[model samples]
Structures are given as structure tokens and as C-alpha cells.
Target: MQKKLVCNTLKVQWRTAKLLIFAQNLTMGTIMAKESYSAVLITQGEHRFYQLAMPSDVLSSCTFVSTRDEDPDKGFQRLLDKKRAKEIATYIDSGHGTIPTSIILSAQEICGLEYDSRNKTISFEVLSGSFLILDGQHRVFGFKLAETKIRVPVIIYDGLSRRDESRLFIDINSKQRGVPSELLLDIKKQADYENSEEQLFREVFDKMNGDPNSPLFGRLSPSKRVKSKISRVTFNAALKSIYPALTSRTPGEIQEILSEYLASVRDQIIRNGGDENILLNSITFRAIVSFFIHAARRVKDRFGPEYTIDNFDVVLGPLFDNIQIAKLSGTSQSKILDYLEKHFKGEFQL
Candidate 1:
């Protein structure tokens, strides 16, 4: 059966050297997709699997969703504000000044492809149950509610495996906002998340709050909402100090060690008196993280790689045990930092 050309919005382009050399057989390495959905696919990259797909159709056939680092298993996140979505829908349906922005997606396969020599077009078929949105959740949601026919533009990365998808999710989520969240929850899930070292810090930050056994669970405040008073920015800033030495550890490994340290030492510090959440104090958390790095770096310099996580508690445990908060109530955070810093440098080994 001939797949229908619903509109002329799709323009075929290729980014592959091999495909360009064999222009006559452009679809040679293409994956076969569904018979119903075909697009003008052009390879324009170092890899054969990456292509530009212009699907000249609305989003009615597709589903829209968001991911959360806090919990991917939790139900999909809130869609665009209904009022905003409706406003965008009106503009889209009206078809005035509608130069559409692209929504990005990643999918597992391309079932089939065939180059149309006569019409100079390329038709593609995407395998079913394989579409995941990496960016532009709102634009897709807006188009879905449009009243009139509108062919939404899409950039779909084809032939991506699950691992590839997760990494791509992190790359896109780190620099972009109001998008994907599962891959790097600590930062990607938060609206104010940043890139570079902060990305690593955010991942570890989120893990401490979201991981099941985390000592900081329900402690850090996410930018999207204020669940706790612990400043995500301040804590993340403090984390950057230790970021340089974190090269050899994965986020999980670091999270475990840090959380364990907190659990072991919480009893010694006077964060609160009774029935009060003293952990919400920004200065205390920041001071603790900063001093840990100061002490850990010293340990690393002396012990070299011999300082294993196996004995983290053996060495760093009692160091925190010396904390004696003179007064938890009305105590300035600066005093806490000074005290922690003194203790951190004073208690070098034990």
C-alpha cells in the first residue's frame, strides 16, 4: 500500500557521507518502520542512524509525557498550564505566522525506508512503542489541543538504544530546561538545573534526597517546588568544592559515602531540639559539605588511593563525632562553619 503524503511540510535531507556516496540507494541502511507513518528522511551526520524527519502531521497520533528524576515510575508530570496550552493552541489552529519550532524525540527503531526516485522523496516507518520525548513537552502538548489541522514539526533521532537514550537525556536535560528528567534527576528534574560540574553535583544532590536510604531524603529543596528549606543552590555551591576529587566515583558511590557520613554523625550535631526540622538550616548543610571536602582532600593527599570507601567511616566517622553545638537555638551559621572548620582541620586522621 502507498503511504499518503499528508502535506508538503516535510523536506528530506541527509547528513551521512556513505549515504551521499550511494545517493541512488539512500535507504540502504534505513530501519523499516510502520507502514502508516512515512517521512522524508535525510541522513546528515557522521552516523548512519541519525536522520532529519519532517512528519507533515499533527500530534493526534502521538502521546505526550514528562519524566522525573525524583521518580520516573511516578505518573507523568503536569502538562503545560491549561490556559497557556489553550492560548498556543489558538495560534496554531489559526495558522497565522506559524513557523513551528521543533520538538525533539528519541526512538528505538526505523522499521523500513524507501527512496522515491520519481518524486525525489524519502518515506520512513518508525517501529511501534518506541517514542520518547527528550525535549519540548509543552509545544507537543499545545499542538495536541489545537482545534484545526496543524502539521507539527519534529526532529526524531532514530535507532537509539535504551542506554543511548538515557545519556542523550542527560546531555539535553543538563543544558535545556522544562524537559526530560529521568536520566539526571538531581539537576534535570529541577527547573534551575545547570551544566558542567553542577550537573554532577545536582545528580548527587538529588540522589541524596530521593534515594530510599538517603540521610538527606526529603531535605534538599527542588527549584520546581519548595518541599524543604534547604537551599538547592547553596548546597550545590558547597558541593562544587569537592567536585574536583570526585573523578573516580559514580554518583551512587559518592551518594552512599556522603549519606552514610551524615547518618553516622547526625546524632552528634545539634541541628534541632525537639519536633523541629533543624536539617533545613542552609548554613549547616553547606558548612558540613564544605568541611568534608577539606578533610577528604587531606586524607586523599596522605593515604593516596589507599584511602578506600571500605574504611570511610573508620577514618571520617569520629571526626564528626566531636561536634558540640553550644546552642542549637539562635546559633549563627557562621559560628557553626567556624567550629566545623576548626574541627575538620584539627582532627586530621581519626
Candidate 2:
């Protein structure tokens, strides 16, 4: 019994020494440093996956597989977008940026992922080319290029067939509808997310849309399907075209000038027995704003510094008599603006 105990003790000592050597190999990066990650296991219909956060540098070490048209046998994933990756890197370095959406990945069976279901964790040894990038190829590369360290949200799937992976890539790219521009504009306002000029123009648009006395009141469409002549995009574009000229002025000053100018145009259209909405049409509005850049200066010079609707009305008197607002339909915005610039130059002899 004493001899048996001695043999058992030696066996235990050998096992402890082997474990110590294995741990030393891990510390030396020979076993590639076994890593454990906490994740939330999500199971849906025959699909199971893990949602977790991983360091960008850790993800950057994984290999990417792209299927090429010229070489059909090459793996699955689209080509890495180097330019987009660089742009994302720049954004990450900008100090107030993050990619909130999870990038999808697939772990090859060779990754030898060991999951502890009871603790909701996964542990794996880092192997060369272990994780296959199924989607967000650029994002992974972007993180690699970024100088900052970030914890990127990751969604990883294991045991998926190559066919299913390709199908998933196709589904994600083709099926998702992007956020509408109008909604984005609205969100930007609530978030106060843009530069001062952008905020200025959007504020001007809001004022014009809401004020009953303004010509644009109730004329701006809030949604993609425009019920009115001026969609938020078109109105913003019109204001943007003239932003440089208005940079010297405040939002209130700019608003007053636009309100007076548009009101004058509306009054002229009404006096000519033409539809006021004709002048309010997006194409016509842009042309008129472009013309205002030149006309405002002439009016301000003649009327001396503080110009009113009557001063603008005098300068625009020849517009209705010579030009037909309805006839401008189907003409491109650039063409209309160019024509009006030339027409006004000759009419006013300026």
C-alpha cells in the first residue's frame, strides 16, 4: 500500500509539471495565447450564434477569404475595400466615433472553439487563419488601420456551411433598406450633430415650413414621397447654393431676406394670374435663389443697405413679363438657373 501511494504521488507530480509547461508555452505565445471571451448565446430556429465585443486588433489578426469572379474556387467574401477601410480609420481617429453595428464573422471548425454553456463563455487558442470574415470585410481592416484601440461589436457563427455563408452575405447586402434622407435630417436636428452652417440652413427651413406668413409655409414635404413642391432635400440644396453669399449675415437676417424675396416672387406670380406654386417648384426656386445672389446686391446698392420686398419687387418686375414660369418644366435645374442669370442681366442691363 505504501508503494502504490508513492506511484500515485509521482503521477500527480508529472501531471502538474505538464500543466505548468503548457501554461508557459501559452505565455510565450507558442500556443498563441489561449483567449476566453464572454458572449450572449442567441438561438433562433436552427441557427445559433454568439454576440460579443472583441478588441479590433484581435480581429485584425484573422484571415480574410474573398471569392473572385476570375477564380471561382477562391473562398467566399467580397474583396476588401481599401479606400473605405482608410476612411473608417480616419473616422475612428477623429475621437468621437464608433461602429455600433456588429460585424459578422464565421469561425472555421479548425478554430477549436470550446464553449462553457453554464458560464456563457468561449475559449479558443489563436490559430493562423482561424476566423473567416463573412461580412464587414472593410470594417475589420479599418480597425486594423486605425491608431486607436476599440472594442468592436462582433457576431460570430460556427459550423455554417460555405453555401449558407455566401447566402447570408447576399441576403445582408440585398435585403436591408438604408435609412431615408428625410429621417436622417430630422434625426440630425434632434441630435444637434452637424456643423454651424448645416444647422443654420436647417433652422431656416424649419422656420419657413412652420410660419404661416412665409411663402414656404406647409410647402416642405417631411417624407420621401413629396406631396408639396419643396422636399427637405431640395430646400436644403437651394439654401446650400447660396450659403457662401449669406455667410456674412446671421440666420435671422438670412431668413428675413429669403422670406421677402420669395414673397415678392409669389406676389408677382399672383398678379400675373399665374399659379404661385409654379414659382415655388423646386427647379424654379433654385434658379430664383441663384439669381438673388446678383439681384440682392443691385437692390441693396440702389435702396442703400436695408432692402425690402418692394425693392426686390422693382428689380424682379421684368421677370414675370418676359419669362413664363410654366414653360420652365422639364428643363434641368442648371439650365434654368443659367438661362435666368443671362435673361436678368439683359432685362435689368446689369
Candidate 3:
């Protein structure tokens, strides 16, 4: 079998050697032509590691060794999910796909890795079935199954004890917290605005939060949980429902309108001895933002398109006066929206 494999490899080398060289050069200096890979060495505390990009085919060809506590010969990784791998493969095949996260791996002693202190790069031979995967098995295999080849970020730890390997795997799987969805939205809103309505409202949302005089000043949590602030996710969901209304408005104008509307609501609730912090609650806030278009429409029909905070304030007068919205604070978002809709459309004088 070994002899047959060697003969086949020699036959394929004549055809593939030039393509392999092209691939090595294409990555600009990271991948070496002689089956060697190099990357900058990064040190954190007592541990040394290399952060590099590897072609998925090369990485997936490396071995996966699982650890078992009873038998040290086996390794620590979880069983691979072929379904998840296939999904990733599909995404990779898609035109706009990206896998930005680093795939963690550990190298054995036999791989002939060397660190150059002068250049601050670690170079290593691409030994078959040598590097043990620590995390991202699915991603690696996904690339293996994919027809499209791409460079994937990788972290290689050169020397780790078996015990340390198990610990590292456990730490990575159990200790890490993913970035919040809301935070991702906020980041996307800033990084790729392109005059999108979603991005516009996000800017308006930020303005409302940053302005000292706005009713929501310092009271909107874009990323993490704050004690008395509304979540960005909830705010985003509410804003998405009013996309048509937001299409024609600028960020500054939207900010002013929302700030005034919120101020009026705050004033009405507080003067009527309602909970002053009612708007801070997610359910109440969602309903208010959802109700924006309705209030705006009423104000526009009664008085022209030159809508102001007072217009929304007067239009929403029946809502606060007739309905005790402060008491509906602890309800579900859908329930709160429904409750307000009944009053706003039917019983209220709007």
C-alpha cells in the first residue's frame, strides 16, 4: 500500500507541482514552496503561538487526534458533525462567504517547526497527520469538502502537554462567550453603512443615546446589558418595522423626531404619576417605536408633513391619557403592541 501510494504521489506531482508553487506564491509570503509554512510568532504570558493563514486543503489534510481521559493515546476534541461541515462547505462555495475566526491547532515534535527570533516568524514542514486540531474541526473539514479554496486564519501552539491540550480545548469550548448579536448589528451599521436605512436608524439611535437632553440619554444599551437601559436588539427590531417611514428621513431629523416623541411620552407618563422609567422597559419602548409611524401618519393627516415633537405629542395624547401604559411594562412585546393597537385604532381619539 505504501509503495503504491508513493508511485501515485510521484505521478500526480508532475501535474500538480506547478499549481502548488503558484498557490504558495499567491498567498504573498506566508506559504512556502517546499511544503513549509511560516507565520509571525505571538507570545502571551508564558505560552508561545503562531498566528497564520493556511489553505483549507492543507489544514484539513492534517490529522485529528481525540483525547480520552482513560486512554492518553486518544485526544480531547468532540466528534465531528458532518452535517455542520457540509453547511460550512455550502457557505464557502457561496460567492460572498468568509470565515474570519482562527482555527486552533497544536503541533507535535516531529513536524520540524522552528522560530526565527530575528524575523519573528515560525516556519514548519507540512507533515501529513501531524497537527492536532484543538477547535474548528467542522470548519477545517468544511473546507476539505468545499471545491472553492480559501485561506483560513489559524493559531498553532508548538509545544503543549497532553494535559494542557485537554485543558486548552475545555477552556476554549467552555470559557469563551460569543459577541452579542446586537453588537454585531451595531458594528455592521458603522462599518458598512452605504446609506442603508438600518444604518441610518442605528445612527439616529446612537444620537438619541449620546445626547444629554434626549429622553434616552445614556439609557440605550447597544452591546451589553445595562441596569436601566433598553437593549439595541429590541430597538433594532422596532426600527425594522418602520422601514418605509425611515426611507425619507435623515439621521439628524429622525433623531430629533424620536427624541421629542420620547420626551413627550416621558412627560405625559410622569405628570400623570405613571412610572417615569416605563420607557426604559424593553416592551414599552418597542411598542412606542412601533407606534411611531401611526402617530406620524395621524399628525401628517391632521397637519401637513412638517411634523414636530408636539405633533406626535398631541396625536399620542389619547394613548397615554386613556391607557395606563406604565402598568403594561412587564408584558410581552407582542402583547404590549397588541394592547396599544386596540386602543390606538379603536377606542382612542387619535
Better of 1 and 2 by TM-score: 2
How much is the lDDT of residue 337 in candidate 3? 75
Encode model 3's per-residue lDDT on 292-334: one tens digit a residue: 7777888889988866777777877877788875556857877
Residue pairs in steric clash, candidate 3?
Answer: 66-74, 66-75, 67-74, 67-75, 67-76
Q: Write down the TM-score for model 3.
A: 0.59
lDDT of each: 0.57, 0.78, 0.78
- The TM-score of predicted model 1 comes to 0.38
The digit string of per-residue lDDT tens for model 2 on 1-350 reads: 99999999999999999999989987775677567899999987777889998888888876465666534774655667799999999999999887898888888876777788999998776665677777788888889899998999988887888787787777878898888887777678678787887788777877777788888887877546475458777777788888888888877778788889888878887787788877556777787777778778878878876657998899888866677666555357888777667677775343
Model 3, position 114: C-alpha lDDT score = 79
If ranked by lDDT, best first, what sequence of candidates would result?
Answer: 2, 3, 1
TM-score, ranked from best to worst: 2, 3, 1
Candidate 3 regions exceeding 4 Å error are: 1-54, 61-101, 105-134, 145-170, 180-195, 210-213, 221-224, 231-233, 347-350
- For every model shown, what is its TM-score relative to the native structure? 0.38, 0.72, 0.59
Clashes of each: 16, 0, 5
